[model samples]
Target: MARLPEPLTPLIQRTSIRQVGRILSNTQLSPFSMEMRISWNAPQTLPVPGQFFTILPCRYPLTLLRRPFAYSAVTESWFAFIYDIVGPATRDMAKLKAEDDADWIGPLGRGFPLPSPDVKPILVAGGAGVGPVFFLSNVLAGRGSAHLVVIGAREAKRLIRLEWPSHAEVRLCAEDGGTGITGTVIDGIGQQDMADKVFYSCGPAPMMAAVHRLAAECGCPSWVSVEEMMACGVGACQGCAVAAAGNGGPQEYKRICDEGPVFASGDLIW
Candidate 1:
């Protein structure tokens, strides 16, 4: 594992907000993915890109634990997430209709750090990781930063549809060559000039590891959002521990929920 000179620190630390959010829409984005929009009252602080929230189906008594999801889009009184229907909880979530209420705790965990004004931003996302990267691209665009977004999936049907930010450039790739670029996200990334650019990625473990290696080769800083099976959305259960590289010191573990879902690529033993 590689290590950067400075350690990555938690950027946001506000107390978690628990609320019953009303479902505004539950739309299917692709064959395997669904987008759920929720609206709440009392206007709370919006979540930053890469921060996650845990949601539980109010009607499903069989589901014991809440599932963590990253924000795909956000507004003043509403937010949305893109989820894959992979388990009992997500299946139930897909069944939910408008006007239903779901229990959720939000704005938890750390988020991606803002890039310096002089550096270009390159965001890579695949599978379920597209949500946060999409949100981040909009944020960067709002700040007058032109960035590149690379999204990948196994096939065209698996790719998510979104009203992408107009200011940011996008590259789409699929393994089956059913979409934009006929290769993986790495192939799209390879076409860019990496100098003076910072990389942020989220996807399957193997894909992120590949991005980390590419970033290292380009001598660019990289941050990754890790996906793990989390029993507790908080650090109490210690269920989502990722091994730390420790640089030259003793190895340790960091909690993905508490310490980060976002971390410097060099900070973890990928």
Candidate 2:
């Protein structure tokens, strides 16, 4: 991994129009990739690495509060969010343009804890799951931690390029072997004891599940971000819950909105 430089962490207190700004147009990173910059009206609080922010669409019934988007990257003035148009909420989000304000709130939820400074060769990310990890890597790179990236996708064409502060040595894996190694991402772990390092992942449920199992086998501490259908982005509604980390499991569901969009790999039923 190349060294990523760090910027100062910002202070966050609440959400307001003071924080939400119109889109400044978007950037096409790849044929399938898009990046958007929402203008922040003031010196918004910098999102600590691993933390996320919620964007309430510009409408009411706040119960459909807003979709929680991970803090892709943050600075003193503005922050960027990346998304693919997979459904209605995203389709609407994709249409946002410059000067068009959207309801926004956050710097919400805890992020993955940074790995110990003594540890390097940390495993990084792939695809949309890249959001929180990107923010985390930005902070870690600045401190000279080295990392390895094993990004997986169904095919090479589906992979998206991101601005990695450290730009760790990237490894690619695909189901079709269209690029890099062919097989599930866990194929990369090679049965090596991954103890002492951290594994951070976010993606489809099945993928995260497989990763959870792999992390356990390697004895690596892992973190994952859960994706669930949600109405209220905050804890009020019970729409987005998953099986719990406890013995009873989903018998006691964990709310994705309130309990977590992120969790320790062991604390989830999947």
Candidate 3:
């Protein structure tokens, strides 16, 4: 495994879960993806930018486990999640109509630390990982923080081109050179001065590992949002355990949904 830089512990606060939510709109973004905006009635508080939720489909039976999805964006009364259709759960979710109900449990897990106004923020995302990272990017914009955004996908169509804040510099990458650069998202990072900036990333493990490696090389502390096969979406299942970073001691494991779906980059033994 590649060595990643040590990351700062994120600011954490536990959030209550909502039992039900109504879908306001469910629009297909591409052949395999869709975006849903939902009304959760009254949330204890708005979810921090990097948090995720576990959504249970009221209509699916074969799929017993709730699907975990990161918040792509949020508003006062509504929140959005973007998902790619890969299994029975998501395929059923795609059939949700406006006014349909979906059970939800979240704003679960730790979120990325807020960046200081004086620090430049850089966000890197690949594939479906764009969901959370884009939310964080919007939060940065709301804070009046300028940022650089790098996104990668298998092809141009897989890449998301959202209306990011005007202050953000967006870079695109595709493995097939179908959109921007011809390489991985890590290749898009190039040789920018990461040392002076705060870095946040989410994606396939290999991509994130590369990002963390680059951060280590540049002496940049980073935060990473990770994905795992989840069962309960809460601590009860004891599923989704990931190894903790560091050796020379007892090996430790952290639960993805309960302990985090987000963590300081190098803290995970990737």
Best by TM-score: 1
Q: lDDT score, residue 138, model 2?
A: 71
Task: Evaluate residue 259 in candidate 1 and report its C-alpha lDDT on the 0 to 100 scale.
Answer: 87
In order, the Cα lDDT scores of the candidates are 0.85, 0.66, 0.80
Native-to-model Cα distance after best TM-score fit, residue 90 in candidate 1, in Å: 1.0
Q: Which ten residues in a row have the lowest lDDT in candidate 2?
A: 1-10
lDDT of 2 at 142: 79
Per-residue lDDT tens digits for candidate 3, residues 205-228, read 998888888777777778889887
The C-alpha local distance difference test score for the whole of candidate 1 amounts to: 0.85
lDDT of residue 166 for candidate 3 = 82
Q: What's the count of clashing pairs in each model shown?
A: 0, 3, 0
Off by over 4 Å in 2: 1-18, 41-45, 56-65, 124-126, 191-193, 248-250
Candidate 3 TM-score, true structure as reference: 0.92
TM-score of 2: 0.83
TM-score of every prediction relative to native: 0.93, 0.83, 0.92
* lDDT agreement of model 3 with the native: 0.80
Candidate 1: segments with Cα more than 4 A from true spot = 1-10, 42-44
| Model 1 Cα lDDT, one tens digit per residue, 1-270 | 222323324376575788998999999989899999999653346788898999887777678888999988899888998889897788888899999988888788888888877788889998889999988999888989898888988787899877888878898999999889988889887665666888899888888998999988888899999988787778889999999888677879999998899999888887
Per-residue lDDT tens digits for candidate 2, residues 34-93, read: 677777754344566555667755633233546777777776667887666677667666
